[model samples]
Target chain A: MTTRTVARRVLTLVVRGRGAQGGVWGEAVLREFDETVTTWQALRWAAGGIRVAMRERRRRAADARRAGARWRRVSRRIVIGSATAAAVLAVLNQFVVTIAYEPSAGMQPTLRAGSRIIVDRISLHFGGLSRGDLVQISLPTPAGRISAFKRVVGLPGDQISCRDGFLIRNGVRVDEPYLPAGSTIDCRALTVPAHEVYVLGDNRAASADSRIWGPVAERDITGRVLVFS
Target chain B: MPRRPDTSPQTLLLFRALLADPSQWRYGYDLSRETALASGTLYPILIRLADREFLETRWEPPEQPGRPPRHVYRLTDAGADHARERLAAAAKPSASSKKAATAPTPRLLGGAR
Candidate 1:
């Protein structure tokens, strides 16, 4: 309505310009306005103050935009970092090896219970299978499907038999120090079929093995036990 | 290093005004009148100068009762030196014509839209 009133409103705008920053400048301009001797002078001062306020508001908006961009970069880095880690682990598990800790319920004595073991998937394809090596097999049990570690004792065409507390393969008694001393696990000398091997658990008393489910095919044996850590 | 503010005509005018009394505290209103700068243009330069440590500011008690305290500013030693340097450089011949200094266009603040 009046020049003085308009100047006063403009002074308010100057303080609000700090809405764009900290309001120190706005206060500075406001305090100066109080010293203006005429309404005309005050109006002129307030016009200038408005421009300053708009500049401050624009400056603050830029700062906020920069901060928003920084946050986006940080979140993107977190997401990309997690994704890369998961992919590397998946590749290692599929092609290199699978690390597992097993409570050696079936295969024991040699592989102590509660020890950590690594299944060597790479070696399963490279190295030839032997009669005394420990292997990981996926086969069926009475309850359901099972993943187990067992000792290989009978190769293809080998007649495996248990006589006098020892495991005899093709009439040659194999030295099984891992089995409990003088433990007799009765397995009739059945000829192992081609592409298969007879496997038995070292904890012969508690284990359900080839004696219960028959020999496991070579394709069914997934990996060889590399180490008991 | 502290960032240097722009060297427009208004900014040069302000430098000349402050250089007249380098150590004495200059009031914002007096500066606007002395330099013929709009309060809008005069203040942002003052705030920038203070922010860059080229100038120091203080609040002086009013001369009379009921009058609010005035915000006063004075150039620092660095600001005085810089002001002299800018004035001396502007005096020398340059690529641009002198008319641009007398009525320079207003530059936009913040980012371009």
Candidate 2:
């Protein structure tokens, strides 16, 4: 095609991009192309018209966005976003998993004071309690109830006792590997009742557990410490 | 109001060209040739001027056959006054420079041209 025809088509496109108000300006640009000394200059002029079309399009878009802006539109988005996040966290906190801070040094050597732990709430409900499982359960306190982290030393109908600085479960000498060497425990032998578990802290010397408070009901176990962690 | 008139060097050149023929309605190409501004740069400035009611525009039929009508532009009275004010402000820095050469303390100039 000839440069004149090509330039005319391009100028037409630029005018269309500019929309209604730009049609007049587009005419001015198109008419001036014929006055140029050469076809090349006409093409260049048409090319330059593209810039005007682009600028007009951008300006119109910005103006439309500004005109349609309202507080309700922006505020609704924020509200919905926050509500969705809170609801998801709530479900995760209730059933899937929960974040807990290890409060005191009762479970020392394993969990330090002020350490953070992820408790798997779903596992305890799905998988039955096993011996040596670290579990979080609520224990009665003077004011109300308090959560405690301890290792289950005895399960339902099992005999448990601390003797000669070692743990004995079901008449078998169970090595207390997690505890500090030479740690001593002198608790009497006790058979864990049905639907209950006997628990103790890894720091046997410093813990107040089943030896002093007796067995914890299986239903009272809140969650298990994540095995992966 | 349509905001302040553009006072860039190129825009000032356009203002001067228009002021040179304030009474005559001139075609876009004629003004572009006089001011040496490309059509792309020229049209947007004219649109802004028209939007601000600083320039008036019209359509004039081509004298020959098989030719489209031409867009002709002339500055309004307000545009002429604005162009004059801006031109005078632009000249003040040079005028002040000559005064500074004779004065003991240097005086700060006003807004940028």
Candidate 3:
């Protein structure tokens, strides 16, 4: 083979070893080699190539350091964002709607035992109470305050009485569609005073409510029931 | 692995070459020729200096078509100051050494007189 062929073969091998570092440096080396073809000059060019390979190795180490710093910054942002979302959800649950499950037959047919329900605590703050609205009440008992679910029957200043399995509101018979068929309600007449409401259960036959414990104060109502399953 | 530039003869020679024209862009091949340093010895020093921010690099476009661009380097502002301070500190003699050098030796008077 001619000297030029040999030179070309050597140059190709050296450039291949350059690999990722080959781009501009490789081209410069090849151009310089083409300008000088003597054996002595080729040896000098090989020496220069070795220096470039060492420089490339150091450059890779610096790039790794920069990448590590960027990864740490991204991880910190993710953790902060997740914590912020959890806090907002907690606030919404406390002041807005909350999910709960019915554990008794008090509000049956409308809300069966073990029914999942959503209570709107915010509604009581905006729209005030009204008759026929289902509510979660905190009833004061001898043991402690126990929570109960019932439908509002009589509002303040209304004469409420139960006669022959029916509800009497302000001396007028009121229709109760939520109550189970054939359920009987027998109780004496009593007027719900100011800031008080009479509440009752849908399963009147099996429930202990206003007839037994009397009317509940307006302050004892916890939340208005919105949805049930 | 990255390393700090040592105060070896080769390293000093390369630093002197760069410091001679602190602002001008110096090509790698030209630097190698001027300093009489092998590629293996010269490149590591340049890389270490650049990593420490004592040198800055740039790519200069080729003067002719079909020629690849060349990588050129120069001392950074901080690098020039650091090199000057380090070199000057090395050249300055310590107080004890300076006092010893200046102290006059007593002459043998009897035989000479």
Best by lDDT: 2
Clashing pairs in 1: none
Candidate whose TM-score is highest: 1
lDDT of 2 by residue, A153-211 (tens): 89989998766767888889887788877777878898999999999988888998898
Model 3 lDDT tens row, A133-170: 99998899899999889899989999998777788999
Candidate number that wins on TM-score, 1 or 2? 1
RMSD of 2: 12.7
Question: Candidate 2 clashing pairs?
Answer: none
Per-structure clash totals for the candidates: 0, 0, 0
Instruction: Highest DockQ: give the candidate number.
Output: 1
Worst 10 residues of 3 chain B by lDDT: B104-113
Write the residue-wise lDDT of candidate 2 on B4-95 in tens digits.
Answer: 44757778888888877689999888888888888789889998999899999998888997887889999998887767666665555555
lDDT of 3 by residue, B70-109 (tens): 7788889878766654444334436343343344222211
Off by over 4 Å in 2: A17-22, A63-229, B1-5, B64-66, B95-113
Every candidate's TM-score, chain A alone:
0.56, 0.57, 0.58
C-alpha lDDT of all candidate models, in order: 0.78, 0.80, 0.74
Off by over 4 Å in 3: A1-41, A47-51, A54-58, A65-69, A76-84, A87-119, A122-229, B1-6, B89-113
> Proportion of native contacts in model 1?
0.82
